[model samples]
Target: MTILLFGVTKDIIGSSTLSMPSSSEFGSKRSKTVKELKEYLGKMYPELKKLSSLAVAVNNSYANDDTIIDNFDEIALIPPVSGG
Candidate 1:
């Protein structure tokens, strides 16, 4: 699965996109949930946990922790944003 990064997320990740193992490729332990994905990312990118907030989008829609991610689904990481 490829996750699109935005704002600080992009800078922290050092890439606009990140590739993760698909469910079918690594089996059940690999995780198929958005929450799990977050935890996985936090582990890989420790800086992510320091962000003010983080949101996950699946197929262009904001996704919750329980959201299941398919192997071919479109994923994106939305970082905190503030403007005056």
Candidate 2:
């Protein structure tokens, strides 16, 4: 399974693709929800706790915390996008 990070998350994670732990990968593994993934990331980088206001996407569409992630799904942790 792969988790993609975009925008500020990309900067924080230092990569686009995140590989899950061996134990978390298995048949039909859906190891995380948007909120869970955010908390896990905040644990890794405490600074991110201040930046929790995010728009998460699963398969290119905005996802709520209740959304489930399957191995085949594309997950992207993207912050709100703006341009001028």
Candidate 3:
């Protein structure tokens, strides 16, 4: 799966896009839900866990923790944005 990163997420991940292998290819370490994805990422990049709030988008719509994800889905990591 390919995840699009924005704002601080991009900075933390050190890239605008992150590619992850499918569960079949990655054995059992692949993320199958939004919650798992968050945990997976947090472990790989602990800085992500420091954010006050992190939002996830799947196929352009907001997704909850239980939201199921697949290799073909379009995912994005949107960090908090503060401005006047």
Candidate 4:
């Protein structure tokens, strides 16, 4: 699966896009939830954990931690933003 990173997330992750094995390719033994994916990303890129707030989106809609993700699904990572 590929994750599109935005804002500071892209800087933290060092790229605007990240690719990882999907649950299907990795098998059911791996986690498929957004929460687990967060954990996985945290481990893979510790800088991601330093963010004050992070948002997960699936299919263009905001998704919660418990949302299940599939290999073919569209996912994006949103970082906090500030504007006047």
- Once fitted onto the true fold, the runs of candidate 1 whose alpha carbons sit more than 4 angstroms away are 23-31
Candidate 3 root-mean-square deviation in Å: 2.5
Better of 2 and 3 by lDDT: 3
Give a tens-digit lDDT track for model 2, residues 1-84.
587877787787788778766464232244657777666767776756767477778898999988877667877777766799
Q: List the residue pairs that clash in candidate 2.
A: none
Regions more than 4 Å wrong, model 4: 23-31
lDDT (CA) per prediction: 0.85, 0.72, 0.90, 0.85
lDDT of 4 by residue, 1-84 (tens): 899999989988788899885443333655488888888888888998998989999999999999998877899999888999
Stretches of candidate 2 off by over 4 Å are: 22-31
TM-score of each: 0.87, 0.73, 0.90, 0.87
Instruction: Give the worst 10-residue stretch by lDDT in candidate 3.
Output: 22-31
Enumerate residue pairs that collide in model 3: none
Better of 2 and 4 by lDDT: 4
Steric clash count of candidate 1: 0
How far off is residue 81 in model 1, in Å?
0.5
